[model samples]
Target: MPLGDSITGSPGCWRALLWQKLQKAGVNNTHFVGTLPAQGCGFTYDGANEGHGGYLATGIVSNNQLPGWLNQTHPDIVMMHLGTNDVWNNISPDKITTAFSTLIDQMRVSKSTMRILVAQIIPMAPSNCADCGNRVIALNKAIAAWAPTKNTTSSPITVVDCWTGFSATSDTIDGVHPNNSGNTKMANSWYQPLVDNIEALS
Candidate 1:
């Protein structure tokens, strides 16, 4: 399950491109559910184009809905790249951190061995939100700096560095979401690392 906000839910964004690449790479027939549809996403809903989007890392965790959603899927891996919307909402970083920690706690699910790769959200530029700059870098830095070194509730919480590759070219569609080309680049950013580390995990 890839959990997060508009970036994850966007129709033509990286995740969607990643799905296509996975299919092309022969990882097919997997089920994907984007629950953040009510907020207006440029996504396919029952084969319809809809734009439902908006989310905050803290808000998402506080809801208790993500746990239920995760359980419904029984996911082997959780790819989480979130928190931009929280900045947009003007939520304090501390609260965002707590929400994410709680979300991780909920996903741990009694230590059943689920690998969580929290992709550090990259910098988004030329946006109106005061915090939209490399605020993502700071948030991601917090996760990157802390989660992996310390033990997480989940077995191994790896932080994928989306900030590295996508940072310079991070802005694409509307400077908010990555356009198709940028999305492909984002998928490439993730693929090799995942393949390298996938075999090492339990």
Candidate 2:
């Protein structure tokens, strides 16, 4: 299961590329989940998407509702591609990490066996927003540092370095959201780690 904003949304986005890779890798009945046109962090469709385009991690998971995506899907593996919007919103890394930890904790209760893959949110082109690029890097670092110490929960953390996997050098649809080719590359980032290991990933 993939949870996120546009970076995780498919049907025409990069998610398609990742899906194609997962298919080739023998993942069956797997697909990307999201809501479109930017809803600004509402837990519609049972947590499938809180796709408000400008939302940060704090807004994505709130007290008002349980994330339906985790409850319904209860996915064994989850890819998180959020944080860019957090940059746009000027949120701090500590705050973002707290929100992620909260959401992961929630997911643990929803699906105790799930392995959560926390993507170091992709690096945008210099034009995307300086704040976002910096914040994303920080969030990724924080995730890397945090994933190991939290042994109480069942959700393991894995970081797919999307900034290195997909970047402006390989992007489509301008420097922001990746196009088809870029998506495939980004999805490819999941292959090696997913195949060889399943422990608390980083």
Flag clash pairs in model 1.
39-52, 39-53, 40-51, 40-52, 40-53, 41-51, 41-52
User: Cα deviation of 7 in candidate 1 (Å)?
Assistant: 0.5
lDDT score for candidate 1 against the true structure: 0.63
Note the Cα lDDT for every prediction shown. 0.63, 0.61
Candidate 1 residue-wise lDDT, 1-202, digit = tens:
6677667666535665565566677655444444433222255322111123576777666666676676555666667777778766666666777777777777777236766777777667744765567576677767766675545453677777777766434447666677666677777776655554455552
Residue 18 C-alpha lDDT in model 1: 61
Model 2 C-alpha lDDT per residue in residues 10-70, reported as the tens digit of each score = 3324444444555666654443443343222222222243334445578767642336555
Cα RMSD, model 2: 5.9
